[model samples]
Target: MPYLNITEVESGVTSLAAAFPATDLIELPEPTFEGRTCHALRIGTHRLEPKPAVVLIGGAHAREWGSCEILVNLAADLLHAHAGGTGLAYGGTSFTSAQVRAIMEKLDVVVFPLVNPDGRHYSQTVDPMWRRNRNPAQSGGNPAAVGVDLNRNYDHLFDYRTAFHPSAPVQVSDNPANPDQVYQGPEPFSEPEPRNVRWLLDHFVRTRWFVDVHSYTQKMLYVWGDDHNQSVDPAKNFRNPLFDGKRGLKDGLLYAEFIEKGDADDSAVLAERFCEALKGVRGKKYSPEPGFDLYPTCGTSDDYTYARHIVSGQEEEKILAFTVEWGMDFHPPWAEMEKIVLDVDAGLVQFCLTALA
Candidate 1:
């Protein structure tokens, strides 16, 4: 199964709305950068009141074109669920509209769908593995500085190291025209792309499930990015404490993440919560509690969402957020990707459904 090109994904989003007119779809204009205009999709929120919002974003990495497809397919499934009055689907499992919508009402569902449009375009047109923006900042003598890793450019933990480039690694970058790895540029929030993400997160404070979909890792990561947060309070309170006292494989994964970070406090019990929410799935494989731990990162969407909720001064109370890394190279012809989409989509939607319910 070939991955979806950007235009095909856009058409998919449009078709979703066409299929379900009761749902309102809005395309948020992207801030202009280097002469091109950027934009994102705003879906749902039609008849539901102050619904619990979930932000679904994808393709921050240039080469991971499959993420955009997974998102589009999920949107299409959601549309079908919308018009047909069925619940969200998995291989054989189905969660209901009344059940799911009841959960969604608690949090309005907002999906960015795809973020690195230019990089994505570059991937489709120029390089299959391109990872940054189309801006010229990465060109000239600084060719390696091609694309600012949009994922790494966020205001939160802006200096946190990336999983791939702990220190800057010079490769034939996806945005080949650019230079600089961990090249934050002349100023903070310098890139309009990540800044837009900041603005988007700010726009929806009540979001219960915050997901930034990416490829290459078959894992879902949650809150308190970077060692900075750990060193600061050490009070797991900064996270959304939904997974406390939870059990099972999924919970085990969540617990292992927390336990490893030395954050075994009550707030670190998210594993339990995640597992509880995922209790219905059968015949699925999940890692048992392992000593293998996820390295901490800063300025991540996860940390930002958690911070928004935990801090009440100007932010909303703890809203749940997770960085959903579906799998490496899960791009597709629909058949191959469906399992990945259906599996993670089930978990992502169920999280929101439970939060809103």
Candidate 2:
């Protein structure tokens, strides 16, 4: 099948819920700037209390067409396999029937296939390179100033100028006139897209894992995006005011975000499992690394999800977050994206299995 259009993607969510007995459709509380209602699917057995949840979201960047497809297909595969008592085969990687059943029974697998439908609709119809949600609050009648980079609108060092050193290579901008696509919104969680994601994280209090799916890097990256990770000094972290202007300097000893040694190790271990599972599908080697290894990014989804517990002083469970950049282009052809979707679906299946264990 061709890449799903924005309408079909939302329809896919509703159809999945309608077709499957174990799935429930959750309407996000707010509509997008374009008045599109986004939904998430909760796939698990109905119970009194919640299970340890795994949230896999996609379509953050409008041009990355395959991310949402991968997630929708993954949800379908899991539900079908569990119902039929069969296994799932994606190229060479296969998941057992029991394993699929355990995932359905033991964990609440939440798949939000599309996060920015407005941007996606615009990209599919008008500009294939569009990367932000279609919110014109800051547009000021300039056609180019029509959107906010939803990925960078999260609440992790969102004030990049104050959060990073002058020399750091952070790919974010607050200027509406600057045509670079990574506009970090007027404020943290300013756009409805990121706010909807935040709602999922908040409403699903037991969500322990998150993966904000993206494209074109073939990487599975973990947290500490603001700078290199350091487990030694807990006081020199993102929440600490002492290191406000010292972050984002790669290869510099001035500041490194502090993650617990065990948490850091767990992040790396799960990243490797995702990479390995993807490799098993088609022999495509995916690098597992820290998010800062790519570049300094403030207000990214992965960093924000993982930082919530740290910034909240242990009030919330620490979500082991990741960004799985699949494929080698923002929007690959259907011939190529079809394969990448399977590769990522296999990885997500493995990720859920690992979380269950």
Candidate 3:
């Protein structure tokens, strides 16, 4: 059975701790965010050897089990690769067990697989597809049930898209104050989970490839989502069945190829690169376009991470910050979910190797 409880997660952490000094559990204090405190189990790399660090995160949204599942799978792989040797070309790349172990020696891997544990707990006990921290205020007379949508609550583009897009593709919601969904809270970092995430990243993750995993999409998402401009969106632009064509315009269509990790690209660059990469694979079914179809939602962690780690700093080379939407969150049948999980895991691993490696 899949591990579903915090107790199980704790056991996983403990196992890592016993095996390597690289692993440690981090707790997020309460009241800062209405959800359960998150934990970051860091896998250390030997000091003499230097390898790229990757931060894996999941459970930002309650129903998105695929994210955490992938994270857990990767964790298991790392442990196995460390203990023995297994990662081979069956994965399509030259990632051997020895190489994985060597990579572990040089690289530090940190993961916070469960970001909104309270919300996830509620999802398990209450609604299987629940998305948001459990605030539980809404009742007979309650006006709203808006709990902070961790996916929407990041510090970057903190715009409240739910407020504007009442009829968005994803209809899942609760009263803003309901604490069940769509509640961004009084401000960004208002919730403990997010605050702790910010605190940890700010203090610990100096420079790294940070991925905030989400689910239910066939494609991997990169950056620049708040604006909703069709042109200035990510690779997803090509995925749009309605996308017109690549206008040979570098403005927003295909610009990611030019980005040099820490190139300090603006929202424009991020979106451009994302769309450009997708355009190549979309084939004739989809075409690259301009303008962000997605509106400008602020306080988004992707935007925040991009700005802080890639856009602003000069000391570090470049940090690739990404918001990976695995797939739609509400697909029925467990088998379908398993397929998506595999695709997402495999595709993302390839993407990381190609994009960040």
Q: Rate the local accuracy (lDDT) of all candidates.
A: 0.55, 0.91, 0.53
When summed lDDT is taken over every stretch of 10 residues in candidate 3, the lowest stretch is 282-291
Comparing 1 with 3 on TM-score, the higher-scoring candidate is 1
Q: Which ten residues in a row have the lowest lDDT in candidate 2?
A: 44-53
> Pairing residues by index, what is the TM-score of model 2?
0.98
lDDT of 2 by residue, 226-282 (tens): 899989988888877888789998778999989999989999989999889999998
Index of the highest-lDDT prediction = 2
Over the full model, what C-alpha lDDT does candidate 3 score relative to the true structure?
A: 0.53
State the lDDT of candidate 3 residue by residue for 186-298, as single tens digits: 55666667776676676454446667777544333444443333333344322232322322122343222122323323333443343333333322111112112333344
- Over 4 Å off in model 3, which ranges? 29-35, 47-52, 88-94, 136-146, 159-180, 228-296, 309-318, 328-332, 351-356
Q: TM-scores, in order shown?
A: 0.74, 0.98, 0.70
